[model samples]
Target: MGLNHINLVVKEVDQAVSLFADYFGFSLITNRNSKMAVLERSHQFVLVIWGQELNRKDEIPEYPENFHIGFYQEDEGAVREIYNRLKEVEGLKLDSEPKKIRNTFGFYFYFEKLMIEISVNPFKENIA
Candidate 1:
């Protein structure tokens, strides 16, 4: 088996849902009372968003300093396109512009408390 799904706990469910849907092209699979949402990408991968209610303070979780979700494209141009689109997204914060990182072209940014990275695998064309 590869991987099933990932659940992300966020402060605002709608914002997180919108951001992911816009960037990853996910389709909303389920919406539960404005508190939870399930999104699907490519039919095989699932992303579940859980809203942390302020009334339940103890249930809120913290993320590690470098924790992030990543997405990969096939080419450098696609990565740049995503970076540029991210720059245009209102209220979203970009950590930096796209640049060479090791052998890939990529960039990272913040979506609320989550860190997101999108990159292109430079060696993809070399794979047999």
Candidate 2:
């Protein structure tokens, strides 16, 4: 089976949605106060956002090193593009540079308490 999607616990759903819409090419499809709010790209990769109470009930307590959301960039240049864009984005911190690791190139950035990684998915096989 394919990896379905990840749900983020966000205080501000609109802010979180807009941020991804603006920078990561996401477009909103549906949202609810309690149910998951969904965003999709042209590729149909989905991002689901959940509110606070739901998060407390459902998600595990994350450690500092673990991120709630992670994105994989297509290639090194795409990773760099985001690295440059991070300068203009307000609420983010760089975890590492857009450099090579094994067969992938990537960088990690944080928004509030959430850490998102952008990297090349180097495997040709669909393990997901």
Candidate 3:
């Protein structure tokens, strides 16, 4: 089995959408009001952000340092580039540097109310 998508319930969909699109180059596929937006990386997978019904901080899950979304990358150099790029962002916390993992290279980082991990990898075709 494979993973389909990750849905993040956020307090500000616009903010989250822009952060992903601006930082990671993902594009917005659609928006359900200002409360929700769907982002896509090519045609493969999506990250959907759904905002608060009442706009209350207590209502949404707080972004934690350890909680993150990880994406696959093609090479170590590319992974390190991302790591350096992310270093400029204010108040960002990282779990680890971009490093090799089971032949994949990537990093994990988190910011206020959001977390992400992006990498480059060719789509895996079924092989035996």
Best by the TM-score measure? 1
Per-residue accuracy of model 1 over 1-128 as CA lDDT, tens digit each: 87899989887789888888987899999888878899999898999998887337535457799899989987888988988888987767887889888888898888777888899866778889
lDDT of each: 0.84, 0.73, 0.72
* Predicted candidate 3 versus true structure: per-residue lDDT over 17-125, tens digit per residue: 8778877778999988887788998777788887875355546467655576766555667778878877876666777877655546676676555677766564444
Better of 1 and 3 by TM-score: 1
Q: Among all windows of ten consecutive residues in candidate 2, which has the lowest summed lDDT? A: 58-67
Q: Which lDDT tens digits does candidate 2 get at residues 17-83?
A: 8778888889888878634588988764778877665655544334466534657777778889878
Better of 1 and 2 by TM-score: 1
TM-score, one value per model? 0.88, 0.70, 0.65
Error of 1 at 11 (Å): 0.7
Model 2: lDDT of residue 6? 69
**Residue 106's lDDT in candidate 3:** 72
Best-to-worst ranking by lDDT: 1, 2, 3
